[model samples]
Target: MKISYHSPHEPNCSICKKQCRFYDSLREHLIGPLPKAECAKQFSERGCSLCLKVFPTAQQLNNHRAACQSLPPLPAISGLRPSLVNKRNQAEKEQILEESSNKSNISGIAMDCEMVGGGRDGSLDLCARVCLVDEEEKVIFHCYVRPPIPITDYRYDVSGIKPEHLMGGMPLKQVQEKIQQILYNGEAIWRIRLKGGKAKVLVGHDLDHDLQCLGLEYPTHLIRDTAKYIPLLKSNKTSNSLNYLTQSFLGYKIQNGTHDPYEDCVAAMRIYKKMRNEDHSLSATEFVPENGVYSRMRQKELEKMSPEALLQISQSDFYCWCMDSR
Candidate 1:
């Protein structure tokens, strides 16, 4: 096997192939004040806003953006703190929660869980705490859970879960029922499953594991797992940790000391809302046929199609949050 010696951190410009210290620098090279003229123009026509990669056609770029996280408009993530609540501000936080709770018809919510360990080796993940937040990053539900099995490993360093915390906590079964009520609103489970009830979209990082630990079932269509999101993955197509994704994209630090499910919940919600907030106005010309239909188009036929027509025919591998706009 051959080993390469170049610095892997430095990436090349997608259009000019110029070396840059970082992806941001490469992006600046194409779009900054002193940008390369040809690359700038080409990028403007077909560049992916999130990845900064140039695609072959505008339609391809549009398809790529569908799977990517939308641009972050918030202030720099570093200068920002996690908004730790102190005794003085506790009332304010409670007031905010009360205000948030009054708003019905919440279309989306993000959840995060902290786990303690069970089993002989203390390797089994047992949900010890859960937090859910609405689009406003207001706490909708937060609880420490009493696991069915006895706690073997507290994992206090990461989870901050202590025995006394679960002393008066809600039982797992009760917790599950409460969550379903909030998610489904007043609709019956069958209405949500079969009749397309307005069940709130669940957003989280590695949500499959969270949902499994909770022993809850939601339609896959309504769950947005950030870990499984295509654009949030590494270049090698591996999952990025929530901390890494938060810092890299959202421009801040999280999971700083002890893990707070509320903080994680807010971060995940911000990412989802940002991605879903894109103004992807769909025209009559912008519609893709049903699955397995577009691939039948011949190469020559695809070449002759207009960019909008090509977009109309193209399909995304994952259901993009942008579709939530519809």
Candidate 2:
């Protein structure tokens, strides 16, 4: 492949794809062929060489590498990091957010959860704090959670949770119910499932982990995860953190100290709103799936189907919650 040098007019960023004024080496990790400038600098810092993406921390990049499908495996990567890896395992909950559902009442709600360590080694995630915000960025609910397991590590450096803070804290069950009330707007989950009751879309970063830790479940289609958003993904197709995303997209810093759940919620919601407002168009021909119900069918079977029939089996390359806004 003919490798090109970096163009002054269009310096590519591996993660956000925003035009950079200077050269960035991370573009090498993209699926496309070699570009103008190959990143010649030897980065001593922990970065995914495959994608030329540099993260704020080694642990963050390590978390990204596991989910990067394009990169080949490396040796002795840290497994001690939390399961930010499988955050992309899209649940079939999309069926519930069917285009026919009502979009009134609450459009969406942003949520953030602070975790403390639990279990024998203090490795398991326990939701120690939770915060919910409305579309107007008002805090609807904020509370400390008394984890089911004894706290082994408050992770004070990040979570800011203290032993005293969780004292007489709300139970996990209560937290779940309260969050559900805000999400479901007093409607039962079953009604939302059966009669097409539109629950507010839950917005957050790496929300799967938070939902799992809280023992909560919501329709997959109603989830607006910044971590899995296509435009927010790294060039290597791995997830970016709420911090990096906030700073890059929103022009601010967060999680710089003991993380604030409200701050995180605002960041997630802001990004979601920005994405939702973006002007874009989708064409079926441009977003063909390589392997799915439509692509796997035999030529004869496909030939027998009508245009409307073909449309029924089609799917997009990525999920965009903004489509629902239309």
Candidate 3:
């Protein structure tokens, strides 16, 4: 093939500019064709000579010789120093176990609130009930808190809680404290373990709001939300109500008409456990990087996963970012 060069100082070669069959003959008249042997050596060092990208030095070029375009992209975590990452991973694992141990033996709690039909401005009506359950699913604590706002929806059809139920109920502050006490008491044993170590996991459905409502902050790793575990439910398909996951996973229909604090708590814990088991299994698999042809093929398979699945993989702490970056 003919070759052409552009330079303001030198006159252009007609034969080189034209498409010629003999590159070697033209090479004699111009800068000689890159020394074949040298080009091959550079190829082993710098990559395709035709690409014309320069390496910092010949040494770097030599190192690039083994480079292959077929390799899979490096994982995101690969950029992290291996020694530092290992230490952080070990620390996180220890923290999880310590938190689990601290919270494990403690019973779970469920909460439900009744509100009026006054839109967002409307205040919560009736009592906000909290039910604390032990391992056997028995309620250990239950109480109702009278809200500060007036009850506008006294119609029996709207809120099942009647004015009579509020008569003997404690104030909202007292109710909140009582609920906190029960939770604190149940977790006291774990706290001792945690003091010697760390905190335990808290299982709940839409728990972020609940924890906020209760004025509590739970550790992110310890807070397991059933809503996050099943992305399929969250995607534009169906409502992520506790009732759906309960019926789908546990095969038990719940929240038919009124809310049951005890039942809701049990369901949340059950769902959390199930999802945790699945995550554990996925974590056990060994990750391997393919080389040459196999690397390209494996990468194509990974690309086939749904965007959501790929995102989950990308976010995973186990995945090496350095590997993904490549």
Question: Which number leads on lDDT?
Answer: 1
| Model 3 per-residue lDDT tens digits across residues 92-124 | 644533443355465344444433332244443
What's the lDDT for residue 1 in model 3?
Answer: 10
| Range of the 10 consecutive residues with the lowest summed lDDT in candidate 2 | 71-80
Report how far off residue 58 is in candidate 1 (Å).
25
- Top model by TM-score, which number? 1
Per-residue lDDT of model 2, residues 53-153, tens digit only: 55768888779766532211121111212222112122422232222133355587888898999888989999987887777666566677888878988
lDDT of 1 by residue, 1-326 (tens): 11112222234567766655344467568888899999999998988655577899888887876666433333222222223211226577456455544467578888888999999989999998887888876667676788999989999999987786777677899779767877777468998778877777889999999999999998898899889776566656678888876775566678877887877887888777766764443423323334434344454566686754544344434555777877
Give the CA lDDT, 0 to 100, for residue 250 in model 1. Answer: 62
> How displaced is residue 230 in candidate 3, in Å?
4.7
User: Model 1 shows how many backbone clashes?
Assistant: 2
lDDT over C-alpha atoms for residue 100 of model 3: 30
* Range of the 10 consecutive residues with the lowest summed lDDT in candidate 1: 1-10
